[model samples]
Target: MAAQFRRMAMWTWPGAVYNEHPQRMVERLQEGHVDIVIPYICGQRDGHTCWTAEEYDERLRAIIEEAHRADMKVHACFDEVNAYRAMPVYDLRQVRKDGSIGSVLCHANPAVVDYVLDKLRWTLAEFDCDGINLEDGYIFNQNTIYDPAHTTGELFQVVPVCYCSYCQEHAPIEKPEWAQWKQEQLTALIAAESALVRKQKPGAPFSVAARMPYDRSFYAPHKQEVPYFDGWEVCQSRDALMADWAAWLRRGHIDFACPMSYFHSRRLVELETQECRHLSPTAANDIWIGLGLGECTAEYRQGNGDDPATENAKDPALRNDGAAIEALLLDQLRVGQEKVVFFSYEHLLDEHLSVMARYR
Candidate 1:
């Protein structure tokens, strides 16, 4: 059999549930034969947030150096708004109707854009890294819409944004409004950031984590609905999402697009790989599909905690071992995608490392 595709592991500093330090995580990755490390710099959960630059620089730097020694590229993850709903900088325009702040910011606001750009600039200046990954940066609620009560033609939606009195004061003036305007704002923000980064470091890599839409009308009606911005489901279908991403790639906005293919079964991976190949021929050659190692295990599928399952869900008596992960990696290589990234390193253990080692 042909050698399997190379593997990249994800590591988060200040640690997530596993609480592994960067140095130790690096060691594990090296042993696993990982070719790249995508370290999580910042992320949000509920109301709490974690960032490595402030507290774990010493450890982070050490890990980066070690990975470099091992010939591994380091990809820094800047999570703009994954879950906790906080931006590095706050925008006054993204206030909610109830007079409270929202989790995400309005990309239309210059201040928000500046805040993100500054952060990216700082990261490139500070780190000796290969590239940067912008995770969930362009994400917005599909239920959002233009609010006439707040401002004329002002874009509003169910995302509960820009209620800080500024956006409310300057709502848009146009009627027969469309939520596409908001999407355009977001796309512009992404493009601008990508441009700025490239200007500073030509050929540096950039990517966005986009939601997968299965069909054109999947997010319709709700595509631009307020309080939720529901229409995204229509425009963000799988084909549409790929097409949108193709435009970015064609424009040379990003070096690669890593779609979140969070599938549990090997079959699903095969199917998605075919679809991606068909939708993005160029990206298919360069794309690195993101898979959830911690979440795809048999124990995870059975809804059991992290405990190992007695038998494989697909084959009882065939213990849930490193074989499952090996199968996944092999499948990725079979589909012509050479690069595969694990969701996180902090969540991995010795067993996970062993599985990754098989491919290496």
Candidate 2:
């Protein structure tokens, strides 16, 4: 019983066999009243090394054609650092604090940026996607660097990372400094990717599925806080990543920002939507508050990397329920006047589809 959204979208992840059949996937999406479909094409590592660029383009075209036939637009969704094995091997790993290594492709390396841009360029030119959505993989990880011993003999540690001589050759130093450099590099990357998308297809929508900032009050009276760095500052400071999404949105570097506000509480959803609106009033309309659904409660517990002991003790009624989901969607539309996108078709059930039909 809420007003309809001007644009409705759905996101899909890799290994989601629910999307094995593109036509069927498109049909289900259409049935759910989705106006756009963003399917994750890049696997664990970059798509280029996973498969030939030509093959990637061919497969995307097949899905694009299927969506087009159903009157739905397709946006090529890629994970920025979701690859387990990136091509051009040298550009794949991030340096950890203890001089160990991380699996994500390092942002400090221009070669990695070039690889991502090249893929975007070729995909835009060869495929008929309506837009591009780059999902930032700057999620939380361990910070191992230790600060000097305090007078009290307390050891302060940090997640000094991406210290590979190569990263230093490009950005210099680690941890906090790496954060600023990471923002700079990622900003440039998004800017460059946007430019490429426009060059290939002028006026094409370019977006990012960015990380949502931590909501200080989500757990409230209980006094438990979501991991701040992992969800917010850590990716920026430790991973040398940028989730200061509003700045990018305001600058027009990105057309739309679908922040992953994966909270179970509808109240928290409103809070984040308000925060994003305040952060970029000029582009608030461009912010689509991403809502989680279908196995979301389980996914939150199992996937988010936070201490399960703490999070598991919370309410079980937080996510993926038909009535609760309807309330969340209505809250976005009514309170935020914002658009919404569900996580994936894999977790979505018939009841979820039934709720979406009301908006249609």
TM-score of every candidate relative to the true structure: 0.72, 0.81
- TM value for model 1: 0.72
Q: What is candidate 2's CA lDDT for residue 282?
A: 49
lDDT of 2 by residue, 1-360 (tens): 247777778887664422368777777777778889897766434433445545554566677888898889888786656445445544466777677776566765677777777766766776678888886564323342211100111222445556766666776464456556666766777778788888888887988886655333333442333332233333332232344566677788888888776666565566667767766774336888787775554234333223334444234554566787788888877764546777876777778877887775
Identify the leading candidate in terms of TM-score: 2
lDDT of model 2 at position 344: 70
Predicted candidate 1 versus true structure: per-residue lDDT over 1-360, tens digit per residue = 446565564645346422555566667787877877777665333433454334555555676787787788887776654334344454433455566655465556677777778877877888787887776545544323321111122233344343444344553512233244454556677788788778877777787554443343433443332212233333342322222554566577777777655545565456546556665766444577766565433223432111123233334322223565677788886666777776656546578677777766
Q: List the residue pairs that clash in candidate 2.
A: 44-83, 44-84, 45-83, 45-84, 143-159
Which candidate wins on lDDT?
2
lDDT of all the models against the reference? Answer: 0.55, 0.63
Give the residue spans of candidate 2 off by over 4 A.
Answer: 17-19, 43-59, 138-158, 174-178, 214-241, 298-306, 311-316
